[model samples]
Target: MQQAPRPRFGIMTAPMQVGYHDVLRVWREADAIREIEHAWLFDHLMPIGGDPGGPAYEGWTMLSALAAQTQRLRVGLLVTSNRFRPPAMLAKIAATVDVVSGGRLDFGIGAGSRPSHPLARREYEAHGLPFHDAAHAVGSLAEACTVIRRLWTETEPFDFDGKYVQLTGAFCNPKPVQRPYPPILIGGRSASVLRVAAEHADVWNIPGGDLDDVVSRSALLDRYCAEIGRDPASITRSIHLPVSYDQPGVTRDAIAEAIDAGFQHLVLGLAAPYPAGVARWVTDEFIAPSTWN
Candidate 1:
């Protein structure tokens, strides 16, 4: 039997409670490391973990800057909330980043934050955006995916009459550097979202911690893909595992488990106040040990 491909590792520096220079410093460092395959930022208008009043840099704006600053690693928001921007506008912004990075953009997106997370939910109202019900959010996301893909691939200007979104004479000029378009990585665990991923995503990502829960979620995604007559193995399985600065051993174990669970794409999330050489430290502690054949 053919051996499974080795898991590829990346880093996510959440742009919360951190300064612009600090984040730029980390991304500059990670850019030189061959072991780090991609870099990511989370999409949030406010601090979700640190002090509520602390600084939170907008994701897409910062991402464009980072794309200009880095050369190798693929870059994107860990998962952009569809509710944050209209689909056509977002498609244009993403295409610009893809061009800036010379085609290194991974379009990670989702059906916005869940209602259960009060911290994440508050951002919508604060930003003068509507916070709709979960069913509406999921339905809108599915349609957003369709509209965005068409905006990227369709040559001529077209109109979209989606239930949650509508566009007239929508067209993207100076298309993305990537042929067809940048890879779509949909991040979510809901059954409805998984069904959307089954139809649209090139990659499917979920947060790690609950291995049993994620394993079952991945299985559900496979079933959804099957229901649509798409190959279950076609969608790459990605997991976001948080890094432990003090306990590298614990992180190593999580990496080992996630790899065993068949997660081919691993994004190691780094917490704020990142230590010196954190990227290299991650490779030394978690990636190298877990990659042993």
Candidate 2:
């Protein structure tokens, strides 16, 4: 039998409704804390919660800055919306981040947000980005993954003519510092997205809410991987669980449950207006106790 993947813990600070300095401070603190192995930010052009018109930093640009400031923890956006940028351009941007962070980038991408999410949908219109239907989103995501990977690994310039993407003499100049390329992390819970994940993602992530639902999604992903002749165990299972300062025990229980369900990569989502020493508090209150148990 294949051994299960070892657990890894990380933190995500959603950029919405928060100041840059506050996010930076938390990440800087997490950088020094050994328990925090990775750090992430969400990709959004506008706020999804709190005051709808509140400040929201663009993910990749902020990520590059954070990468320059921090030394130890691996860094990435929890996901980049495939609809937000052209694949080749995204490939270049990600490569630059990997170089900036000395190859610590875990490149996360997905078939944008669900069309039903009003807040997520509004951003597309607000930023003059087109929000396509589900079919287009998924198809484009599949092609985007293929194009981005080739851009990173292929030596010679190449051309691509997929239904959803087109390129000519496309090439990435500064390849990521990580050999071959940085790990690709695909985040989503849809069957179509899972199929894509099975083929491309080194790590697969879903937001945590209903345990049974996520476990079922993981099993579906396993089926997808098997159909492709890939070992389901080869892909790391990542879950993003929201953290509550006043309800650490609740979060800890969720962590324990997710671990029991074979989720090896845990991303704890920290709400903004982070308290002083929040990173250390997370370590003490959640990670250490859960892992020790």
Candidate 3:
């Protein structure tokens, strides 16, 4: 069999003010698209870091803008919460975005966590929903996967019955541009999350943690995949690395170590001070170097 393509490198945009739209435009123009295989944004109502009053853009809307502006780069949320909307609706929205992006979409999913916005929390409370524990959250995620899969693959309307979500005759029109739906990426580091990724996800995106944590968790994920009778190679491993390289030549070593340990993608977080400056550093130091090659 032919060897699989080398894992691609990509960047995740920090949530910022709409005025920073021009920053994205500039990055794309500066050959960032050629350097990065994928460009991701977070799905959040407000900044997850720094000043709470800082401006942040809506993820899906930003993705839509990216789809319209870029031709070569894949675009999507780094991980969208399953609790934000019903699965059927989210699936349709994903399909629409995929079509708009000419089929370059990575559907990243995650369980809901503590809301960063008061309005979001209020909405959740108003719906009479309980704040989910990890187990409940994973179960809800499984249900979401079921609904999304059924909407994309089943010809007839389907019903989903789950503890957290229930759908009667949910249907999606104009099936996704990618056959059998776009790639599903699950984001987390817990054992339950690893099991879910082994069972459902095409990609596994783990957050940046201690180096030992990443290695041990990645090994656990491989074990889970084997136990589930799935090839470990089928699941792509990716990581989100923080952007805090105050010194030269550190980021490259980190990337090398991660790649050696079977990580295929690296999403650099630009949430620190001087995001635009960080963007330039990533493009010049990481992308322009031989790390990806």
CA deviation > 4 Å runs, candidate 2? 1-4
**Superposed model 1: Cα runs more than 4 Å off:** none
Q: Comparing candidate 1 with candidate 2, which one achieves the higher TM-score? A: 1
Give the range where candidate 1 is weakest over 10 consecutive residues by summed lDDT.
284-293
Angstrom error at residue 5, model 1: 1.1
TM-score of each: 0.99, 0.98, 0.87
Candidate numbers, best lDDT first, in rank order = 2, 1, 3
Best by lDDT: 2
Q: What is the lDDT of residue 47 in candidate 3?
A: 55
Ordering by TM-score = 1, 2, 3
Q: What's the residue-level lDDT of 186 in candidate 3?
A: 92
Question: Between candidates 1 and 2, which one is better according to lDDT?
Answer: 2
Residue runs of model 3 more than 4 Å from their true location after superposition: 1-5, 17-20, 30-32, 114-130, 272-281, 291-293
Q: Give the TM-score of candidate 2.
A: 0.98
Residues 66-177, candidate 2: write the lDDT tens digits: 9999999999999999999999999999999999999999999999989899999999999899999999999999999999999999999999999999999999989999
Number of backbone-clashing residue pairs for each candidate, in the order shown:
0, 0, 0
